[model samples]
Target chain A: MINEGCRLMVVDDELIVCKRLKQILEKAGYDVTVFNNGEDAVKKLELESYDIIVTDLKMEGVDGMKILETAKRKNPDTRVIMITGFAETETAREAFRKGVFDFISKPVEIDTIKQVIIKAQKEISGSKT
Target chain B: MRLRIWHKMIIGMAIPSFIALLGVLLSYGYIDDVQKRHGYEQIADNINDHVLEVRQNENYFFHFKNGRFLDKLHKAILDLKNSVNKISSYTVEEIGKEDFALLQDAIRTYPPLINDLYDNYLEETNVTEKVRAEGRKLESFVAEKNRTSELTSSFILHLRLLEKNYMLFRNEKSFNALNSKLTEMKKLTPHCFECNPYIEAIHNLFETYKKSDALVAEIQLTGDRLEEITRRMAQRERQRIGSFLTKTKLLLAAALVLLSTLGPLFVYKTATYIVAPIIRLAEITKKISEGNMTLRAPLREHDETYFLATSFNTMLDKLQLTYNSLERSIELLNEKQAQLVDSEKRASIGLLVAGVAHELNNPLYNISLTVDAMKDELNELTEEKISEYIEDISSQSKRAHDIIDNLLDFARARKSTEMEKQNIVRIVKESFNLVANQMRINNIKLEQDLPDEPLFIKGNHSKLEQILVSILTNAIQAMKGNGTLRVSLRPDPESNRIVLKISDNGQGIPEEEIRNIFEPFFTTKPVGQGTGLGLSVCRSLVREHNGEIEVESKLGEGTTVTLKFPQYKENA
Candidate 1:
C-alpha cells in the first residue's frame, strides 16, 4: 500500500505510553518517533516534519494544543492526533476546532489507533495523486 | 372572704357608720328617758302642790272660824289624796318610791285629824252659846233685887267675857285664866242664889275649851308630817335623773372611741388585702423584665386584679412559647447548614472522581492494546521482547492501582476525623491530583514549591486535605486560560509550624469585599455557581486541623491563601 512506511510521531508525558505505541506501530510497518514529553516532541516537530503526529493533550511545559498548532502551521497536510489521560475533556472539544485529525482517550486500543492510521494513510496517498 | 375592692371599701365605711348608728340609738334612748324623768319630776312636784293647797285651806279654816272654811279644807285634802295617788302610780317604776309612800301615809292621817278638829270646834261653839244663854236668865232673875242684883249682874257680864276669851284663844294660858276668873266670881256672888246659875255655865265652857286645844294640836302634827314627805320625794327624783345621764354619757363616749380607732384599722386591713397582690405582681414584672422568664403572677384575689394576673400569666406563657419556637427554628436551620456543607464536600468529591476516572482511560486503553499484541507474539517473541511486554503490563497495572489507591485514600480520609501526624507534601500532592485534570483541561499551569523533606503536622488528614482541596478549587476557579496556580509548603523554623500556601494568577477579590469573604453566604461567584459557605467551611475545617488560614488579594491581580499548622513531632 502507498501508506506503508509513512513517517509518524508520538508524544506523551508517560514513558510507557510512548514505548508501547512505538513498538506496536513499527511492527505495523510505519515509521514512528516517540516522545515522553510534549516539549521535546514540539521541538522535534519544528526541526523535522512528519506525515502524522500523535501527542498527549496534557504535558508539563508544551501541551497538546501547542503541538497541534505548530504541526498544522508548518504543514497543513500533517494530521495531528491528540491523546489524553482524560476522555471528553474541555480541551478535547477545542482540539477539534483546531483541526485535529483524531482524538484518543487513555487506555486506548492499539488496534483502533492502527486502523485510524491506516485510514489516514489511504487518504494521504489518495490526496497526493 | 373573696372580697372585691369595692366590697372591702364598703365594709370599711360601714364600720364607722355602725358606730355612729349605735351612738345615735344610745342618744335617742337617753333623750327619751330624760323626757320620762321630766314627766316623773312634774308628777312629784304636783303632789307637793296639792299638799300646799291643803295647808293653805286649813289655815283659812282656822283663821275664819267658818263652816265654809271646813268644807274648803276637806276638798283640798281630797285633792291632795288624788295627787298622791297620781304620783304613786309612777313610784318605783320611774322615780320616788319610799318617799311617795311616806307622803301617802301622812296624807291618810291628815283628813282624820282635820275631821276631829272640826267636831271639837262645833262642840266648843255649842257650849259657849249655852253658857251665854244661862247667864242672861240669871240676870233676869236678879232684876227683883235692887243694889245687890246690880253687883251680881256686872259680875255675870265679866264672867261671860272670860268664857268668850277662852273659846277664841283655845290655849292653856287662856283656859287657866278662865278657871281663876270663875273662882273669883264664885267668891263674890256666893250669897246671891241667881249667881249659882252663872257658875254652872262657866264650868262647862272651860271643859270645851281644853278639848278644842288638844284637837288643834293633833291636826298641826299631821300637816307637818305631810310637808316633810314631799321634800324627800323631790330629792329622790334628782338623784335618779343624775344616774340616767351618767349612763348615757358613758355609752356615747364608748361609741366615739370605737369609731375613731377601729374604723381606720378596718380600712387599713382592707387596703392591705387589696394592694398586696398587685404589689407582688409588680415585683414579678420587675423580675421578668430582668430576664427571668419563669416567673408568674399568683391568682390571689377574687377581683379585677385577679383577672389581670391570669391574663398576664397567659401572656408570659405565650411569650415563652414564641421564644421556644424561635430557638427550635434556629436549631433546625443550623442542621440544614451542616447538611449543605456535607453536600458541598460530596460535590467536590464527585468532580474529582469523575475527572480522575476519565483521565485513567488512556493508560488503561494502552495497556489493553499492548496485551493483545503480546498475545499474538507470545510464541515467536524473543525473551527481551517478552520481558518488555510483561514489564508494560505490570507497570501499567501498578500505575492504575496507584491512582485508584490514591482516590481511595482521599475518599476514606474525607469522613475519618482521626487526627494523626500527616506528611504535608504528600497531602498537597494528593489534593492536587484530584483537581489536576481540571487544571490541565483549562490550560492552567501548576507550580508546586514543595520541599523534598516531608513537613509533618498534627491534624485530621481528611480535614487538612479538605482545606487544600477547597482552596485549590477556589484557585482553579479564579484562573482562566493559561493562568498559573502556585502551591508551596514549608516548615517555619521559628514558629515550628508547617505552612502551606496556594495562590492563583486570576481575578482577585477587592480589599473591602475580602473582609466578608469568610462570612457564610458571602459569594463572589454568581448565584448557583457557589454556595458561599466554601470559605467559612474551609476556615472551620482548618481550625479542626489546628491550623490558621489567611487570605490576601488585590483586585484583578490574584488571591493567595496561606495555611499554618503546628509541626508534629513523631513520638515513635
Candidate 2:
C-alpha cells in the first residue's frame, strides 16, 4: 500500500503528544488532523471520520474510550489506536472489545504508532481491494 | 429505698436509743410511784409525830393534873387533827384510808376524854381540901372529949389508929375495920357535930376519886387507841416505802436486762447488715482487680448495700466492656501493625508503580520518539527543524527526569520517616500527580477548592503523599467510569489544623459499612480484589501526623473523607 494520503486523527490532552505525534505521522506522508483534547476530537468525529484514529486513552472529559467508541461506530473500517500513560488491563481489554486497532502506552514511541498506522493504512487499502 | 451508710447507722443506733428511752420512761414512772409513796409516808409520819405529842401531853396531864398539861394536850390534839387532815386522797388510795379514818375518830374522842380527865382531877383536889378541913375539926373535938374520960379516949384512939391503917393500906380488911371504927366513933360521939362533918367530907372525897378513876380509865383507853393508830400508820408507811423501793429496783433491773440483751442484738444485726454486703463487695473488687472481670456484686437488701451492689455491677459491666474493647484494640493493633508493613510496601508500589509508569513513560516515550525521529531524519532534516527537534528532545528528557525524580522521592518516603515542615499545597499537588492520570482515565472530574497560599504542615512528605494517593485511588475506584471528585484544602480556623477534603460523587458507602471502613481487613470490595488495609493505613498515618480523618457519607449520594493535619509551627 502506498502511504500517499491516508487520513488520520490524533487525540490527546497533552499538547506535546498531539504536537509530536502529528509531526511524526505527517512527516510519514499521512494526512493527519490533531486535537489536543478529546471533546474536540469527539466533535470532529461527529462531522468527519478517519481511516485511522490515534487517541490517548485518558483525558479530562470525553477520553480515548469515547473517541474509540465514536470512531468505530461511525465507520467500522476506521482503525482506532489507543495510547495512554495508564496501561490498565481492564481498560485495554475494553478498548479491544470496542474494536480498537491497537493500544499503546505513553510517552508513545513515534515509530511504533507510525508502524501501527502504516499497518492500518495497508489494511484499509487491503479491505478496499 | 437506698439507705445510705449514715442512715443505716442512725437507724441501727436509734433502735437501741429508743429502747433505752422507753426504759428510762418506764423507770421514771416507777420512780414517780415510789415518790408518791414517799410523800404519803411522810404525811403518815407527821400524823404519827403529832399523835406521839398528844400522847405525851395526855400522860403528863394524867400524872400532874395541871391546866398547863391540859392545854398542851389540847394543842397536840389539834396538831394531830391537822396532820391527819393533810393526808391526800391519792395517799389515801395507796395506804388504806380505813386506818386513817380510825385515827381521825380516835383523835376526836381522845382530846375530849383528856379534857374530862383534867376536870375530874380539879374536882378531886377540891374534895381533898374539904376532907383536910373536916379532919382537923374532928381531931380537936376527939382530943377534948377523950381527955375527960380515959376508957372513951382509949376507944377513940383505937378507932383513929384503924383510920390511919385504912388510909395507909387501902385494903378490904382495913376498910372494913375503919368502917366499924367509924360506926363506933359515930355511936360514941353521936353527940359530936364535928365528927359528922368529917364523915361527910370523907364521903365527898371518895366520890370525887371514883369519878376521876372512871375518867382516867376512858382517857387511857382513848390515848392508847390514838397511839395504836399512829404506830400502825408509821409501820404501814415504812412498809410501803420499802415495797416501792423494791419495785423501782426491779423495774430498773428489768430495763437493764432488756437493754443489755437488745442493745448488743441490734448492734450485731446492724453490723451484719452493713458489714456483710461490704465484705462481699470488697471480695468482688479484689476478684475483679485480680482479672476476674466476670465477677459481679450480688444484690442484697434494699439498703445502701443494695445500691452499692448495683453500681458495682454497672461499674463491672463498664470495666468488662472496656476490657473487651481493649483486647479488641490490641488485636487490631497487631493486625494493623502487620497491615502497616504490608500496605506501606503494597500501597507505595500499587499507587506509585502505575503512577510512575504513566508519568515516566509519557516523557520517556516523547524523548525516545523525538530522538528516534531525529535519528531517522538525520540525513534529510533541515538545521532549523533539527534544532527544533533537539529542543523538544531536551525538554521531553527533562520532563522524564522530573517524573523519575518525583518517583524517587515517593519511594524515599518509605525509608525516611523524618518529618519536616512542608507546604500541604505542594504535597497535595505532588500526591495528586500520582493519581491524576488514574482519575482522568476513569473520567473523574476534579474540583479544586484550595487556598492560594502554601498551607504549611509538619509531616513526612512521602507519607503525606501516600495518604493522599491512597485516598484518591479509593475515590477514583469508587467513581468507576465517571464521577466528580472534589479535593479541597483550607486552614480550619477553629482547630488550627489544615483540613484536606476529598469528596467523590461516586457510589457512596452504605451507612452500616461506613463505620468499618477504617477497620483493618474490612472491605466492601470483592474478595482478593482489595486487601482492605487502605483506609486503615491512612487513618494511622493521619494519626501519626497528629491529625484526624473523618468520613461523612450518605447512601447513594457520595463520600467525603476529610483529613486534618496539624499546622507546622515555626518555633516547633
lDDT of 1 by residue, A1-129 (tens): 444669999988877777777877877777899988878887888898999988888777888889999999988888888777665656767898888988876666777787778777777777999
* Model 2: per-residue Cα lDDT over B131-223, one tens digit each: 667665666666766664522655656755775675456466876786777776776657666667777876675676667767878877877
Q: Estimate how well candidate 1 is docked, as a DockQ score.
A: 0.33
Runs in model 2 with CA error above 4 Å? Answer: A105-111, B1-342, B413-420, B566-572
lDDT of 1 by residue, B141-241 (tens): 65556567336666656656766777667567777777887778667666767666667767666665666556666666677777666655666666667
CA RMSD of all predictions? 14.4, 13.3
- Chain A TM-score of candidate 1 vs. true chain A: 0.91
Q: Quote model 1's TM-score.
A: 0.51
**Leading candidate by lDDT:** 2
- Number of clashing pairs, model 1? 11
List iRMS (one decimal) for every candidate. 2.4, 2.2
- Give the 10-residue window scoring lowest on summed lDDT in candidate 1 chain B: B87-96
